[model samples]
Target: MTSRRDLLATLGTVSLAGFAGCSALPFGDGQDEKSDDVALPAATVEPISWPESPFPVAVPSTLAETHRDRARELLTAVPVDPAVPNSAVAEELQSDRERAADRLETDTQEPWPTQELSRWRDRRHAAATVRGTYRAATGEDDAEAVTERRRAVRDELSAFVSAHEYRASSPLEAVLVHAPIEELVSDCRRRTRPGSGYPADPVADPFQAGDAVGLVEFADATLADARGLRDAYLADRSNTSAQWVPLSDTSEQLQIALAHTRSTVQDFLEHDEPPFDADLDGTAGRWLFTEASRRVETMAEEHDVYRDDGDYARAILVAGRTLAAIEALRTTIDGINGDAYRDEVTVESVTRTAERAREALAAIDASESPELAAQLCRPALDTVELLPEVIEEGYADAGRVQGELAWAELYARAVPAATAFVSERLG
Candidate 1:
């Protein structure tokens, strides 16, 4: 293995190579007189590739049969609330089952096939039985009933996790299988206080379906993941005789790479012409920078948590993913134009964009012929009216909110002719 110093030196070379293609472009939107003279630094991006698929492993035919039988037994026995005739959790489970039904079909790769498909199909049928018992659980007046059912379901889930330890042949394989399961269990353990004053609901309704169907789906996925991990571990173990690299070495390299990328993004925003004008202009650019920064910070936080828990393998996997996200952000940043479409997708940004659209609408309403103005800008006005709902109910992430803002701005700008006409009449 290369020393950390040597690895970083190699990364620096790659960063400089990436920058070579970008340095010649003129900085800014032709707004600054000295923009043409500004020199651009190379983006400190490292080349991080995803793990290769562990295929062509020898799988025992009986493995699938055992999995299918186990899935049917577990799912058929899941409990539900006695009183709630119609649960929102049931609707959610049916939807999830339908969405996952397609995974039942086997892919081109084979050898250990039929059992996985059977397991999925059996789980789907079991879901029908689950949705039937939870009616009326979604109503506001039934919050107590929903919480009661949730607690019951959570108790079962906690027991399941505690009783089963899904292990694999290798550390990396073990990390992949256990991480998602542990994360789910941790969420289940959190105490939900009614007036906790958190940003949003810690989990979805009924805690993202603390119901029979949801529990079965979770069990099936966990088992499937464990199966896949076992296969991969066996394959890798057969193919490679070398020992795994030291965790400290990889961790140090990731730390240096993250710092480098963070600094590069900061440098661009600070020194580039047109500035970091997220409020009025370059919204996408600002958002890209903000998200990239957030991801870098998150990677560091994840690393700390994993290390403290002595899960070095999981930390390494997270670092790889973080690098990939940073690389993608850098690519998007390179493509940014002088537009607000990609601005930081926050509640504030959403509200601001909606206000700008409202101002445009007011101008049209105050025109010499209000009726004609409405006729001319009907589509724009319709889109602007929908903004209040978006403002009231925030989005899942920065990307989604950013896209909404961008489209809203696009629709607002589409009515340039109507706005111009209104201004002309008023003048």
Candidate 2:
């Protein structure tokens, strides 16, 4: 287990003499240091304040009540069962996932215009031939007219290709556009439209509107569910108790669940799979519920730290440093295998570290004693020091990491000074 003190001590050691040039000793030549002769600098430190709590103080207050009401509404709207194989929501969720997957595969398989330009060329040739036949039959061919007709054909083809390219380039945008089309098609096919049978204004019916409304409602409800889960996890401190698992032990599980949820939602919106009833109660719904619950719980716990009368600023600074160190390490790792290792660590790891850093920072109270400041600053410093090793490992194969040589040099220079600052302030 990595203790706070250990992390800090490592930081202090790395920063004091390794990175920062400043020494732990007093400045100037060695002389009889007279306390009376020495004049301390005036205090320039400003008061630091904590941020407002995201959750309300009163459990039964408007905020809580509203959330509760929303939760109840969601539960009523979409009944879920963890053990059951399929529910309405699960079916919907699965259908969405399949659709998304189909879209993704289609997008991937669809070659760039440049790769399929020959097809367009053939079409243009055919059009030109038709124009030629018309001109020959009429015996009224004008060079300018022929050029203009060809230009128009080319322009239209170019625009069509460009649109496909744009959609192919951006998965998110493609999904957004595809979602409405899927919804429209689904609504039209369904018999849930208002009126006993299709009549006047058949195109614009309650079912279509209801599908749109349902999509929006589902999005809002999902966010609310996530928030609720996060809050619950944070409030429950007992790690070993049933129904309240320790966050540390369950982080990986939660991450996987979240990823699955995100994937399911993406798939549903993209309409990759055939419409199925199991989607709503499937992986997407369960994952969303689980992940959201965990985040809310974690965030709630973090909120409490801000309320504590601690050195919040320093804590934040420490967290920033920790993140910086982690980034540096990542950079170092990237340098190791060159571009081959790029995106290897996964964005999720970085995001998780950042979240933890934010929580740790919130727990810090900058108004604490110098000793506490040292303790708080230590972890960040140590993490920073490890950057070089990470970089070195990254570059070990190539003998040197590229694009980060300057950063390595800078870290080497700054570590000592930073270390000295912590030591002087703390000791």
Candidate 3:
């Protein structure tokens, strides 16, 4: 295992090599001018050599078994919004097509895949085709037609893969381990798209990657470099030049607060989450939800955050994901109130986090959020910074780090504060 110092030194080398060797990664999205890793040369990103015809030519592994009929289940499950006029559906779809056109027009402006990834290039084109088909399809497509359409799409992609002669990578499994952590989570949350690499699929590997779907394909060397970068980020929070990860939340803060209350009222539930009665109802539903939540919490708490020279870089990546969810709260709140009626600390904290989150989201290819998320996580991230020293120094250190601790405690308070603020204003 490389020591912390050794890892950082190695990362410095890999970053230099990556920039000198290929297109820059799609991170930060020009948000941080200081990130030297995102820039690339003008030789044009050429397609890499592909592998022999034995490529996995079926549906995605997880989707293969169920997709023949189950592929459209997600779309089928969506209930038409009764409030939306049937007359307007076509117009809305037209607008969507126009937006997609706009996206393609700007795709070149976004970060091109830095690695020699044939799939990335191939997937982009396929995604366009699928988007076009879906947009053009009338709701009248019969079940048989839908199934055939799904098969045709799969065949087209499989043909694309088979034609390529892969060299450096196995086209079957692509696991991205690098890129900013917030960006990672954003990629995971992206709705499954035809060419989006089955990002919502569970990563089959052993890396404790959380809701991070198998999107963003990082080269082996790049992940190695990321390990060092994450470690450096954990320790170097106070540096003025440091690039604090920008995580963006597009969730509406008022809506989030309102939704929680509405849910409670509708259910006549007192708790934000109804205490699961596992004994009374042996359903695995809550168990699964609890496990998922536990996975996220454990990732944050057990991450190498508290080490004096902590070094579990992958876990920290997961921690970044947890932070993104927390930060999303604040991002949704941004611009709605413009810090109105919010304290300086709370405003400043979320504002700072929102900026970082947005930058991260854009870098990771998020098409903005549905609503802004909570912005009260900055103080917690900062407080978490001191947790290591407190553990090491015990009671003496606790007093010295009281400010950070207090801020962490108050970080949770943002929930109630925001709820009250929105409820009061709405009332």
Candidate 4:
């Protein structure tokens, strides 16, 4: 198990780029622009091309039963509290396991994007780690002094988990633009602490206590990945016209986006799924999207802090998702009638387009109206993944963007209606 000190140290040092000399890049946008003082990245960036249409993963009853049977496999060794929420713990863990399994298969199968292969595998590994933590917390290793240690571990993890917001990439556009949703989903699910269910209060219920502990260790690892992607943008920022906004603005934008996301999810749950060109209206068709929307809403409420306190990494994560939510809602309702990509989508062209995006971001001065700046900044951060320096070999990274300029024009379009969405209800 990773200690609290170790986790903080790791988060502090993590960078998006691991290659040597990558950290020395300038923070400025290379022109006569004022510094926005954004920090490093924290969460991973989902691509903008993944399917926005929802697809459900049915967890067979037999499979769920199997996991439930083994949920208490580790509890027998330790002196567990009689009130341990075994069923709730099992359900949450199994939900994670099933989701990870489904994503692993989908990500690896033919035609689906493989650019995020490593992230899916890492989630699989994380699910296993949760199992391990569950076992360890139950005193599987040394039954002698388990109770005291479990409480201490849970307290530490609870504090860490509360500090970060974990929500799925809402709106299909956000899902497509951001990194893999499983990363956020898994993190959010772990924080559920299903054992206690409501309020998720940290309890001495050892069998039900591993969720927080496992998420803490997993967070440390994901932060490193977030750094790699974030640093990639930082390194490229000096070349593009993208300017930074105040961390407070970024936080405010995130808070607004999150609140909007919650309301959107509530709307989604209350009404029928928005009519898609495809036949995605039935229960099976809407299951995954509905569940994800619910989770996003729950998370928005759980970690509703409005101030970032100068943490740039947190700002980047929030900004990226908020932008995705904005764009996704547009796509879902407005509908992409035909190909949304441009005629030419080469690396150079995309880079030029991305620079235009940065220019747009730079142009939206927060001094004009912090709310508009906050709204537009989300789209600006969404462009980070489009930088030529960060392009990789995969459908999301190269295929769609290279083949069709997937999200190349998003930032450019975002500039006109940063504040109009409220009046127009466009999003």
Candidate with maximal lDDT: 1
Can you write out model 3's per-residue Cα lDDT over 1-427, one digit (the tens) per residue? 1121222232442342132211111122232222222222211111112111111121122222222122233223322321223445435434433432333233221111222122222223222323323322332223333334434544543443243221112111101112232232222223223443221211221111211111221111122222332333333333322111211111132224433433332321223342443221122122122222332344345433322222222233333334432333233223112422122222233334333323332232211211111221322332333233223322111111222222233233333333234223222
Per-model TM-score versus the true fold: 0.37, 0.17, 0.23, 0.31
Model 4 scores worst on lDDT over the 10 consecutive residues at 19-28
Please list the Cα RMSD from the true structure of every candidate, rounded to 1 decimal place. 21.4, 29.4, 23.7, 18.8
Error of 3 at 124 (Å): 6.4
Q: Which stretches in model 3 have alpha-carbon errors above 4 Å?
A: 1-87, 107-145, 149-427
User: Can you write out model 4's per-residue Cα lDDT over 1-427, one digit (the tens) per residue?
Assistant: 1121222222232332221111211122232111122221222223332221111121123322222223233223223232224657555545544543443334222112222323333443445445544454333442322333334445544554354332212221122222233243334334433332211323334333344344443443333333333333334334322222333344455557656654653555455453345433221122223323332343343334313233332333434434443444344234323323323323454455445545544454422333333333442343343323233311122222221122323433444443343212212
lDDT of 4 at 354: 45
- Against the unseen true structure, what C-alpha lDDT does each candidate score? 0.39, 0.28, 0.27, 0.34
- Please provide, for model 1 over 23-65, each residue's C-alpha lDDT reduced to its tens digit, 9 standing for 90 to 100: 2111233322222232222111111111121222334445445
Better of 2 and 3 by lDDT: 2
Worst 10 residues of 1 by lDDT: 42-51
Clashes of each: 10, 58, 27, 17
TM-score for model 3? Answer: 0.23
Query: Order the candidates by lDDT, highest first — what do you get?
Result: 1, 4, 2, 3
Off by over 4 Å in 4: 1-147, 153-344, 367-383, 386-399, 402-427
TM-score, candidate 1, is 0.37
Among all windows of 10 consecutive residues in model 3, the one with the lowest summed lDDT is: 166-175
Candidate 2's clash total is 58
For residues 113-136, write the lDDT of model 2, one tens digit per residue.
211222222222222222222222
